[model samples]
Each structure stands twice: as structure tokens, then as C-alpha cells.
Target: MNNFSSPKIILLEGIVNESGSLHFFEYSEALPFSIKRSFWITEVPQGGKRGVHAHKKETQVLVALKGSVKVSLEGTSGSKHEFILDQPNKALILPAMFWSEVTFDKDTVLLVLSDQEFLESDYIRDKNEFDEY
Candidate 1:
């Protein structure tokens, strides 16, 4: 659906096909950009906060494959929103220039699909710097 293009934070649909013990998530066009890199976050300590930053020019889709996680996003104008993702098919599309903080539950497994490759310079880690950037 590319909800990001329409000023939406999330896409409500995805394909879930389970065969025996394998489950597959198919996101054909739910996201605005094609994923160029994929990674998963695991072993996060309880009540841990990850991704306290904003991307300069990148997009990501976050999914909680195992357990629930809270994603809080801060807009450039200081607006904030939070989403709890507990399902694998429900993906949150976080656009660039939005500061995000992820709170993970115990035994949570978060899967990330990104449009761009890793570049340390692309991240704005400090809130003060993010506001100015």
C-alpha cells in the first residue's frame, strides 16, 4: 500500500502463509521502497531501548516476529506516536527524518527490513542534533 507516501505510519496488510512448521511473510508492495538489507534484533535485555535515532535518508519496516515491542516515533515537529507490534505480518513503515525508539519485551525477536545499506553517517543519534538536522 506504500502508506508512507500517504503520510501513514503503518500498512495494514500482508501475506501470511504457513506450511507445516514454516511461516512466510510476503510484503509485495506494502512498503514504499524495496528492501536492500535485512537484519534481525534479538537477545534484547528486558525493558531495553534500541534505535534511539533517526535516519537522514533511509526507510525501514519493523516487525515483531516472536513477541511484542513498542515503537515510539518522534516527528520533526515534536509530535509523537507509538505502535505495538506483536504479529509478524503487521509491519510499521518508518520513514526518514523521524526519530524512533524501540522498546523490546523479554524474549522478543524483531525483524527489520531496510531500503538502504548501513552507513554510520546516515544516523542522527542525539535528539539535539536530530532536531537541528
Candidate 2:
């Protein structure tokens, strides 16, 4: 995992896998805040990319299910680090203010859990202005 100061990025473990039964775990015990929405990305192109922005108040957890993905974390000082997520049970917790980009190796399924719903004003898309902020 990459070390981050402002928006703490943590790798979470212990995700269950069932053969025949389907179970839904409560997010109240695991997360600090309630989960407002849930979404997943499964059909990403080989050379495609996503999430080249940062949120001001939202926190997220990303998981790689099928293939692998390289997450680049950009700081305000132009410092950067990359993390490869391949395991189904592992997740990366991303806080606000950290610029992130996702690049998939082959067809990848990326699951994202958010603390809030979709809000356009919360996003900082410009990389230069994102670095300045």
C-alpha cells in the first residue's frame, strides 16, 4: 500500500467467499460512516482508464476482483506512488483530497464503495488544479 498523509489509504482484508450461499455483511460495524451507495465496474477495456480526479469530502474503498489494476496516488508536492490490486479479498481505502487514477491490466472488475452519493461539485478533475489544492 502507498503511504498517504491527508487522505489515508488503507488496505482492508478478510472478505468472505461462499460456494452456494450469498451473504450480505453489515457495513455499520466495518465502516465509520453509513454506506449511501454501492457500485461496481466489471467491463473495462484493456487500455482504458478511469477516475482521474479527487473528491473533497467523500471516502471510498476500491477492490479488484477479476484481473489487476494499478492505482496511482498523486500528492500536492508532485509525489506519487502506485499500488497493484489483484486479490478479491483485499481493498484500498481512499480518503478525500488524494488524486487517483485506475489503469487496468486486461479486462478488470473494480468494485467501489462510497460514503456518499454522486455529486458533481465534489469532484476535482483538473490535475494541475488538483495538485495545487
Candidate 3:
């Protein structure tokens, strides 16, 4: 297991503990970065997937509020890691240039907090293009 500390990998636990319920905590004061946008996924049926790209400027913290999901991360150095997120209070902070994909199991709720506004140009949709960066 790799300890979360890098420009790419940031693991934050207990980010949603204050609300007393996993379904309620949208934001928390314990987060180091300010939230610019908030979103959630509630329709991820089993075998469904989301996120298959990397951001150029946006940084995100992904939390599994309900059920379970798997996050696959590919780094600039060709290193790859997979994290299983099942708890609401924990989060995986993904930085720019790291490609990530999320696959959900059953009725999973994946909440994301972003650091930048939405920009189409900032997104790298091709793995080969992202690897060249």
C-alpha cells in the first residue's frame, strides 16, 4: 500500500464524517483545498463506468458515499494503481496529468469535489496523448 502524498496522489479520510450520514455531507472544513464545484453519481449500476481521462488544471477529490467503486490511476511515469473506495468518509485526491477511471458496483454514489471550473480544453481524453505530456 502506498501512502498518499504527492502532486498526483492524495488520500483524505473522514472528509464526510461531520454530517453523521454519508448521504448528507457535501463539503467539509477539514479539506485543504477549497471546493470550486460539487457533483455526484447515483446511477452507476453494476459494471457501469465513468471517468476515463486526465485533467490539465483541475484537481479532484473522489469519495464513495455509498456502495463501492474502483479507481484506476495511471501516472506520468507509467506507474499504475487501483484503489477500492467503499467508505463515505474517505477520498482519493487526483491531480493533473493522472489518468483515472471509475467503475461502480451496484448503486454506488461517487461524489467529487473539483478545484477548477469546467474547461473542455483541459481534458485529455486520449491515453496516448496524456502519456506524451
lDDT of all predictions, in order shown?
A: 0.79, 0.74, 0.76
lDDT of 1 by residue, 43-87 (tens): 999899999999888888788888989998888888888889987
**How well does model 1 score by local distance difference test?**
0.79
**Model 3 CA lDDT for position 89:** 61
TM-score of 2: 0.78
- Relative to the unseen true structure, what is the C-alpha lDDT of residue 79 in candidate 2, on a scale of 0 to 100? 72
Compute each candidate's TM-score over C-alphas. 0.83, 0.78, 0.79
Off by over 4 Å in 2: 1-30
Q: Top lDDT: which candidate number? A: 1
Which parts of model 3 have CA positions greater than 4 angstroms off? Answer: 1-30
Deviation in Å, model 1, residue 71 alpha carbon: 0.4
| CA lDDT for candidate 2 | 0.74
In candidate 2, clashing pairs total 0
Instruction: Residues 39-95, candidate 3: write the lDDT tens digits.
Output: 998987798889999887778888887898989988888888888888776677777
Query: 40, model 2: CA deviation in Å?
Result: 1.3
Tell me which residue pairs clash in candidate 1: none
